[model samples]
Target: MKVTVIVPARYGSTRFPGKPLANILNKPMIQHVYENVSASTLVDEVIVATDDERIKSVVEGFNGHCFLTSKEHATGTDRIAEVARNLSTDIVVNVQGDEPLISAELIETLIKPFQDDEKLQMATLKSKIKNQEDVTNPNVVKVITNKNNHAVYFSRSTIPYNREKIEVDYFKHIGVYAYRKSFLFDYINLPESILEKAESLEQLRAIENGHSIYVSEVSNELIGVDSPEDIEKVEKFLKAR
Candidate 1:
């Protein structure tokens, strides 16, 4: 399959403005994400989809490809859908701009489901929840999968309740997503479902609409930078490696 990795970046953020331009180890955070995603053998191309010229300029400064998108886009998926609308690739991977520590192998794992099942429309990664705090944290989205490895539901609250068994394994949802080009366009038009609005997760809309989302289990721990405080953690991780 012809796959394109689109990193959605924007200068305006509620917590940290110019987050994509934030420097980590003397290099822009977006550059780190772009480079890591580019390492994937499955990806044919990587591009930054942003509405800000500053982000576009920085991406180009590093000799990376970027496309100027509409500023009115409410979500990163919307921005990616706009870019995917003009692309000719079969699969579009939405690599989150905030995740500077994204793994290429994990991305490759996400795309594997498509090759095996042509009927699969969307897919994402999930890792076992090791941190006790993450289980109850609203910021950390959790997922439950069926026996077939398809996502049954995604929620901020801990799933399965574990009333009978006190120690049940829980899976944390990874934000990275791979979508077929046709599904990408169809997803943007789907009305925001009640479950999605309740949980504040866009992926829930797909599940509510009868679309199957395959969840691939990965061992790597992925950290996404949502605020300025997260940069230090990411930097420490990079320095340790």
Candidate 2:
């Protein structure tokens, strides 16, 4: 199956304007994300979808592929859907531009579910929540999965509320996602669900509509760049490696 990775980058961000162009270890953040996705042996192609000329220029400066998308997109998924609509690939991987630390192995793992289950429409990564602080922090989206490893729900609030005090592992939702090309187009057209709007999470729309999202457990910790402060943390991680 042919797979393509599209990184959505926009110059205007509320938390950190021009974040995709932010420098980390002297290299643009988007470039780091692009290179990481390119390292995936399963990905046949990688493209940067953006609405700004500056971001496109930077991507091309690194000899990376880029496509200009609409500036009116409310979310990265919308931008990716527009690009996926024109592509003929079997699977489209939406790798967030801010995730400079995303591993190629994780991308490979996200796409592997498709090879085994032809019925699977979407998949994403999840990691164990190591601390109580992150579990309670609303900024950290939490997810719970069924016995089959399919996502039961995604919420900002801690789920499966520990009333019984039984030992349970809490998983934080990783933003990277893989979807079938056809499903991407269909998903974009679906009206935003009440749950999705309430949580400000697009993935909830799929869950509300009865579509199953396979959750894959991964060991690597992903640091997504949300603000200028996050750059230092990412830099420290890079320097350690």
What's the TM-score of each model vs. the native?
Answer: 0.98, 0.98
1-241 in candidate 2: lDDT tens per residue? 9999999998998989999999999999999999998999999999999999999999999999999999999889999988988888999999989999998999998999999999889999899999889998999999999999999999999986999999989999999999999888888889999999999999999999999999999989988999999999999998999
Candidate 2 has an lDDT of 0.94
- Candidate 2 ranges beyond 4 A from true positions: none
Pairs with backbone N, CA or C atoms under 3 Å apart (clashes), candidate 2: none
* lDDT of each residue in 132-211, candidate 1, tens digit only: 89999988899999999999999999897888877689999999999999989899899999999999999999999999
Summing lDDT over every window of 10 consecutive residues in candidate 2, give the lowest-scoring window.
180-189
lDDT of 1 at 196: 95
**Candidate 1: where is the Cα deviation over 4 Å?**
none
